[model samples]
Target: MPRKSNTDVLALFDTLVYTCQYRLVLEPASHVSARVLEWRQGLRERIGLFHESYHMPSIILCSTELPPEYERSLVDAIARGSEGFASFNMNIGGVQHSEDKRTIYLEVGEKGIIAALRQRVVDHVRTNRRIKKLGVEVVDHARLVIASGLKADQFNAAWAMLAVQSVMVQQKVSDVVLIKRELGDTSMDEHVRTFALTQGV
Candidate 1:
């Protein structure tokens, strides 16, 4: 699905600020990539499972004042993975605001690979057991969706109205991971908590 539909815009979402999440990006041009796009765009509306429980963890489980940027290693690893996979650069769709979720999301160019990546992330997080209890899943693939809440609704609305046109340089995906973001007075830093694929290899 196109990741920016409002939980407020033609979406049925309850009002609440959720916390915590697990996320990963996919290589757009991968082998089964075609299936993902066909499913998300064409078949999703017909599949009740797609909309009912397929919401991204970042969208429904976590709240962030800041949007997530690719980790330095993640960026490099993805570039390296491009040799074996079909990679597409990350694009910022826009700031999307619903009733309360002022989320900034990255648009998936190769929606298929992104979907596969999501499932892989779910499998990886499950090994943690503890985090598994947190109830994060990988079925619904999306790059990222950090909430801004009502405080930044105006900014989100302004951006959401704008169309997505910018093209980004594609990157590879050597690894997928779950990271913990700790907030500071003026900034936040990520600490790698678990790996969905390879960490050192």
Candidate 2:
């Protein structure tokens, strides 16, 4: 018997179609928590993993591809929606493994600040005619993780048994980062076009 293909399995499931262009997320600053830094460093050492330009602990707001003509409109809408927002607090929860067990992450405990911010962004995007049909789902607890993709499950299992405890900490989210699409870049590229939260401060 042959092994099943990932594509074959994926084909059995419904997936969204849009060129991956932009993502809205929160990248915590270094001062957020000593433990988070320690965990990041430890993961780097133990799994030989490190944060890439795109890899940051984040709370995702919106991720979708829009028509090229609508790009500026989308950007403007995000800017307007996020204009009056200010920094807010969030708490880290413990470890969580995805249903596929293909990823492991630190769960974010529910808090009013993050929820409100997510709602604002969602509302703005949903009302926009350009990408309103895309349908967005705000993850209740932000996922802060050590690793993901092919080897995430292996690392997660090993780390869990290693006696290194995960921490629950609080951090202030001060920025809403926008990662934009770039020419000649694959959908995976992390070319950031703007970090919009500065204007709000």
Candidate 3:
């Protein structure tokens, strides 16, 4: 094979499609995160082989795809939407499977707050022409996925073990974080900004 020249490499790079995806998520407090990690480790020990280290434990608010130029506007919209939002406690516990029984996750009981916040953020971002055209998807269920990509038997085994156990944790959500990832990138999410929630007056 002939060695590729700089010009050829540059051309190939230019031809590649790069899609910028943005997501807004609620990151649990530090202590809450530690407990979740411990629970996950214990689950792995009991269940045998599984791989899901890349997944972050968070309540996804909204997800969308837009051009790089619109990112600044997106951040501004998120900030404005989340301004003066009150902090609340979310109950994260119980093991359940998706309708297809292909995913296992911890249930987030309080849906009111999540829905309200999602609406606020999406409302703000919808003002942008490009964003409106692309459309943003609001995450309906606020659950922390512990394990995914399971076969029928794997799902059954994991659920059978986890469902019987008592697992409950309280996460005090104080802020929401904005994260972004480039198309085809396998690395962890890059943090763009954090919007702090305000205490009730």
Candidate 4:
């Protein structure tokens, strides 16, 4: 069953959990209905998997945000080392959307060293960021999701228009940023924190 966003839950030790359909809490006096109750006998049952939520920050993800200081350094380094490379701009072309159980992302184009640069930024964030490490994974596409409850086929028109234009620019990643949201909305959020690419990718 999907994790509950609200309603019945169980809490053994400050952990809010749900067993069956009932909700639970920690305090000894808290009452629970047998309609849904924690399975005291199944200690061997699998616990669960949890992941840190990530949202694309408004910095490089948005056009108006200030360029990170490290971006200049990364750009200069790439220009010097990568052949056939000149200058590039930070461009976001891929589109992605996720609702309910599904998500969609847009594809980013332009291969070569730009991919490497993107990796560096990802590595830096995964290593240095203070709060929680957003797992590092190379997203090959700048994906856009049309949304759930609607047919994926509905995106045919959008895909056609986007399909014609290459979105990932050969330029700099600009910066890495940390974005925050309330509880959900895992899609993309306005950037609340930022790291510049002017100094490094």
Candidate 5:
């Protein structure tokens, strides 16, 4: 066996650093997504400007950064975590803001379904000590973001405009998506993998 120089060992350590971000999300159907987009456009026009670009409507469960080597194990963890969960129907409606009021989104009606799945995934993935230390914030509240990076006036206007109207759209959530992007990628472009839930008899 040959011995490696210090430089080789340093290079190997650098490669192991986290280089990609992973997001677990529940995406709305195409038709539902269209409606949400329309709603966002309405808000944009009313508010006179929107701070951020558009993204497809989805309820994010959790997100974290990890090294590329862990990707396969993460997929396997998600698969095992999602086992036995049945599909459920949910309504996307109502308007809410984050505590800072910098972001606005549509509220997801059926919260328990997402909460249960998040718990399962956290359990499976966090079993690894390496991942456990990293932040895996699976918040209790789930939402489909409309517009973010809002100014004080923009937030008030958008919120008031949405709060008055009844905006309920229903859709069936059958699967969760695992999305990944490189460390420096800011655009929404990424690889998406779906894990379908078990069908109920």
Candidate 6:
């Protein structure tokens, strides 16, 4: 059964900026990167099968809600601050469901590279006076969303159990992409402007 399209502008906005999220875009290692590609494809297929598909966004490392203007400044600061950090590798562990069961995602386990990278970003954000005023906090456990919104009993319990079992696997992280949500419709190359973490690593 195809899920019905329910495009609520308010809802979409809520989801987009529900919290100000700091994310690192996940990209395949190279043209010949088979392992990571396979894992990503499998997640997409499983989400589609359940009629719970949604565009998978980048991995969010930390999130918070902020005043509109403050959010903009914080993003700019992050861009500047990120320029000092080098790109690092991350590891994907397995699949898990959000506590509310609203989202399915891949678990990101922290390695030394990722840990140091995250700390650097967190420290910069927290210490910045403008950002500090917003009271935004950083969180551990970065994850890539696979799908969101599932109705209980839409299928047997075993369906979700099987789905989780089938696609749980690990892979290497190759790239980090930073993105920001645009406020209104404008002529822009990307709906979310992505910045590659290329300075340090």
**What TM-score fits each model?**
0.39, 0.62, 0.76, 0.34, 0.78, 0.52
lDDT for each residue of candidate 5 in 88-195, tens digit (9 for 90 to 100): 988888777799998888789888878998899879888776666655767678888878888899888888876665667788888999887665423553656799
Residue 118 Cα positional deviation in candidate 4, in Å, after optimal superposition? 3.3
Q: Write the per-residue lDDT of candidate 3 for residues 1-201, one digit (tens) a residue.
A: 999999899667545636577889987656656656665676667665454444456667888876677789999999899998898888887777799987787788779988898888889989887678667988888877777777788787778766775567786778899987765424456788999988655
Give candidate 6's whole-model lDDT: 0.50
- Count of backbone collisions in candidate 6: 4
| Candidate 1 lDDT tens digits, 26-83 | 3333322433333323323332222212332222212112123323433343334322
Task: Indicate the TM-score of model 4.
Answer: 0.34
All models, RMSD in angstroms = 16.2, 8.5, 6.2, 19.4, 4.7, 10.5
Residue 144, model 3: Cα distance from true site in angstroms: 1.5
Query: Candidate 5 vs. truth: CA RMSD?
Result: 4.7
Better of 4 and 6 by lDDT: 6
lDDT per residue for candidate 4 within 65-98, as digits (tens), equals: 1124433333333233232223345344444444
* Global lDDT of each candidate: 0.36, 0.60, 0.76, 0.31, 0.78, 0.50
List runs of model 3 lying over 4 Å from the truth.
1-17, 35-53
Residue lDDT tens for model 6, 50-140: 3222223455555444545565565665566566455554565466777776666656665456666666666666766755654655545
Using lDDT as the measure, what is the rank order of every candidate, best first? 5, 3, 2, 6, 1, 4
Worst 10 residues of 6 by lDDT: 182-191
Q: In each prediction, how many residue pairs overlap at the backbone (N, C-alpha, C within less than 3 A)?
A: 4, 0, 0, 37, 0, 4
TM-score of 1: 0.39
Off by over 4 Å in 1: 1-101, 137-141, 144-147, 150-153, 156-165, 183-187, 193-201
